[model samples]
Target chain A: MQTVKLPPLFTPPTPDSPVPSVPFATPLPDIHVTLFRNIRNAVDVRNLVIKGDPRVPECVLINAATIVDVFQIQMACTKALLHQQQGIMRTRSLYSEILFNLSPTNNISDAIRQFGISDTTTAVAVVMVGMQAPPEEVRLRLLTLIEGEPIPLSHLPEFTDLPLINRIYKTGNVAADRGQTLALVVGAMALKGHLS
Target chain B: METHEAILIKQGAEARVYKMPFGEGRCAIVKERFKKAYRHPVLDEKLTARRVIQEARCLQRLRRAGVDTPTVYMVDTPNSLIYMEYVDGSSVRDYINSRAPMNDDDERLLAQSIGKSLAVMHDLDIVHGDLTTSNMIVREGSQSLVLIDFGLSMVSSMVEDKAVDLYVLERAMISTHPDTEGMFQCILDTYGKSSKGGKAVRKKLEEVRRRGRKRTAFG
Candidate 1:
């Protein structure tokens, strides 16, 4: 499990300047990423998210193999915060926005299909963002929701499918170096909606 | 409201650049395009939003084409903010100014690399509207030149636009750094050898330079 505290997306309202053009939640929540391998109930977990079960925290379940680096998740979370702040999120929920932000295209269904879990997906990375509940409490709840062994995020690269990720982002001729690949992928994600 | 510290690094006419803490002990640059009070509110919003998207698009487009540019982390169009990789390097403007007598080999290498980068950008039809020594950085260790500040960048296949881009850099170099005529010539030679439409652009550059001189003389 890895926890990252993101900086606020907007400046706080000051006494002299009482209101901002866009109001944001008082404090943004930290992002928690937990990796699970050899999942026994991948289908059940997907169904819970699809069914909008309250037990599921505000989180997105990503296929661990598609994650090139942990920074990718961090970038998506940052974008999701901005989307939520502006109320311009294309998806129904903030959780879905995080998943959609990871995609290189604007199609919500296509993003879910590519990054979401499947019955054969043995490894999954659960990304929880902006939850009022404590991380440990969420982790305990997640253990019940997902029947799998918890692994540290450092082991994520072991499950990373580099070729698949490159194909998805269409990064041609870029060396297989981790930093280089991550840069291109993150660039693609940032430019998704604005790409001509 | 929770307030995190963001140090103001630069303030320009269009935007303000801040250095802020990002994920996992890393620092990223945040460029915010403030609203212009001189323009109508509705027109200002539309213009600022377009510039924000345009800058982000060019940065990504050049990065995909294998040019060394700041990696964009996020773009908040509604708020007119762009979060990008913080380059920990000295700008070419500073690098040149700091060296009293710049080394011949270093200057030649820097010119060659800058030319190559510009060639790649031009081949992709990316016209860096504002090209100057201050906009280019020499990365600390790798010594590769990384372009920054794409607020005025655009996509155009016109030879005239490409020539004008080079002309802007030429005028900037001449005004800012002394005795850089030879270095500028070296850059042009490398660019001619590397870019596909280099010959036409070079010819157009000559015409542009002549026109520039004529305007200055008339003024």
Candidate 2:
């Protein structure tokens, strides 16, 4: 991932920081091929993450300014994938929407501190992870990086025409008075014929 | 940031790992939360979310307190995956397994840092439920050991819980790390000074050890 420090004016409206603001959340393009590839890798990561290497992914630390841009990037990915779908399946693989700004005062630390997800991860595509670390780590101590052809979203029904699950936490973001709050979001790619 | 080709590391019980590409082509580990059929659906959801939250909390705390661990990236709670900066080096297990013991000062320094970290954790009332040597990884560069997998941890003030956590690790080290008897003591020696239950916990540790001795003798 490339980090382009957007001159102050390009920054999105941040929760706390004094950085300048802009509306980073943008609409998806008719066919954003680059985004489609990423979403597919993220959601259908079974082959990439499970049977994959054992090194850690380089982390990109986000300040308030860049976080919103990242959100837009993810939305573009999901939308791009969704637009390329063929037909509906027995069960949907993708789920989106919900989780509006619960309270205007909610910030990143408060979100991380409370197990409430940052607004950044609104539309993430994931493949697989298990109860413990992946099984691949045992055999190969140091893994070779992921190297292969990129899978197109068209091939993966799970990503192409995904479905949105019921709304989770639409009533608000952070609970009133920061009292006890319980938020839940459920999305799963059903194994073929697993759920009717 | 130096980027190395992605490598597959050992997978643990709860997460799948990948050598993720990071800044300047460097690699880090990406953990994925896969599904488990053994657990009831409700229980699974609770456990998964709690564990993710707990791990993230520990990393944040460690980073802030100046203890070294990976920096977190993309906390995809839905996917139950956390992407973070990968530490480049062998686990303490690997280091001990291959090279054997180090000199007095090296061992003391290693033992002291570990002791200090645990002490810090306990002082903060964070109990790492599964405190095996495997959970403590030694990273290169700083030669600092990082604590990974706070999956079963809880924030508690109970002295018994913290003692048990250390006790569990002592057991794991004996079985796993080679020639770890006296060497491991270096860690406790340090832990005894800083831990809340320093004296009492050490005494209980002896009882736990005696029980082990008796079991081994009987068997």
Candidate 3:
């Protein structure tokens, strides 16, 4: 389990709350990521996402093999937050926006198809954003939803589909160093919609 | 307006740069173009939005062309904010000022690198409108030159545009650093050798220098 606390950039406009609110003191919510391998309920999780199940938190379920590093996820999460802040999300939900932000293209369906979960997926990375549940509670809840062993994020490299990622990102050669590949991939994702 | 803690590092005429914490204990530089009260709201919004998109486009294009640039993290269009990688290094301006009487080899090396990068940039039709020592950073360990501040950058394949770009850098170098004519010459020599259309741009640069940046209809 890995947790990334995204610091707030700006205070949200104060709503008409019954309690008096401080002018500029809202702490932005954090994003939590948990890796699961040997999953048996990928189809079920996908179904939940399709149905927009209330049981699921505001989260994005990604095929862990497609991820190059944690930084990639962090970048995607940051983009998603920006999209949400601007009220310009292309997808129906923030989770879908995160998944969309991870892809190197502007097509929403294509992004989901590439990064979203599949029926045969054995490894998954669950990214939850701004959840009120504690980390332990979230992990336990995820165990109920997904029949898999929770693995540390450091083990992600072992399951990474490098060839697939390279093809998707068009990162030139296979021998490219991890740092270079990561930079190229992140650059592609960031430049998706704005490419001219 | 949800507010997070961000330290304002630089307040320029166009944007306010903030060093904010990103995820995974990393930091990102956020450039927010504040709203201008003087201009009409609609025009200001359109202009700011266009510049933000243009800046991001140029940075990504250069990065794809294998130029060392700060990786863009996110662009907030509504807020006019561009989040980018926080380059951990000093500006070329500071580096040059700190080094008292740099050796010939060091000057040559730096000139060659700058010339090569500029060549690549111009070859890609990117005119870094405000190229200067202050806009380039020397990375800490690698000592690689990373270009920054694409606020005025644009894509134009015209020889005149490319020439003007180089002229801007030359004038900036002359004014900012003392006794840099030899260094600028080295830079131009390397650029002429490396870039595909460098010869044409160099010829045009001579004309640009003679005319002093702006072209006159009478001339």
List each model's interface RMSD: 4.6, 15.9, 5.4
Q: Which stretches of candidate 1 lie over 4 Å from their true place?
A: A12-27, A54-58, A130-137, B213-219
Candidate 2 contains a number of clashing pairs equal to 51
Model 3 / residue B109 / CA error / Å: 1.3
* Tens digits of lDDT, candidate 3, A1-196: 6876664554322223332222232345677888999998888988997887877765789998899888888778767877777788888888898899998888989889889999989998999887777777777778888899998888887778988998887766632677767777787787786674
Give candidate 2 regions above 4 Å deviation. Answer: A1-196, B1-8, B40-43, B212-219
Pick by DockQ: 2 or 3, better one: 3
Chain B fold agreement for model 2, TM-score: 0.83
TM-score of each: 0.91, 0.52, 0.89
What is the RMSD of candidate 2?
19.1
Q: Which predicted model would earn the best DockQ?
A: 1
Candidate 3: which docking quality band? acceptable
Question: How far off is residue B19 in model 3, in Å?
Answer: 2.3
Question: Which residue runs of candidate 3 sit more than 4 Å off their true CA positions?
Answer: A10-27, A52-58, A132-137, A173-175, B1-4
Which scores greater on lDDT, model 1 or model 3? 1
Model 3: lDDT equals 0.82
Task: Write the number of the candidate with greater DockQ, choosing between 1 and 2.
Answer: 1
Q: Each prediction's Cα lDDT score?
A: 0.85, 0.46, 0.82
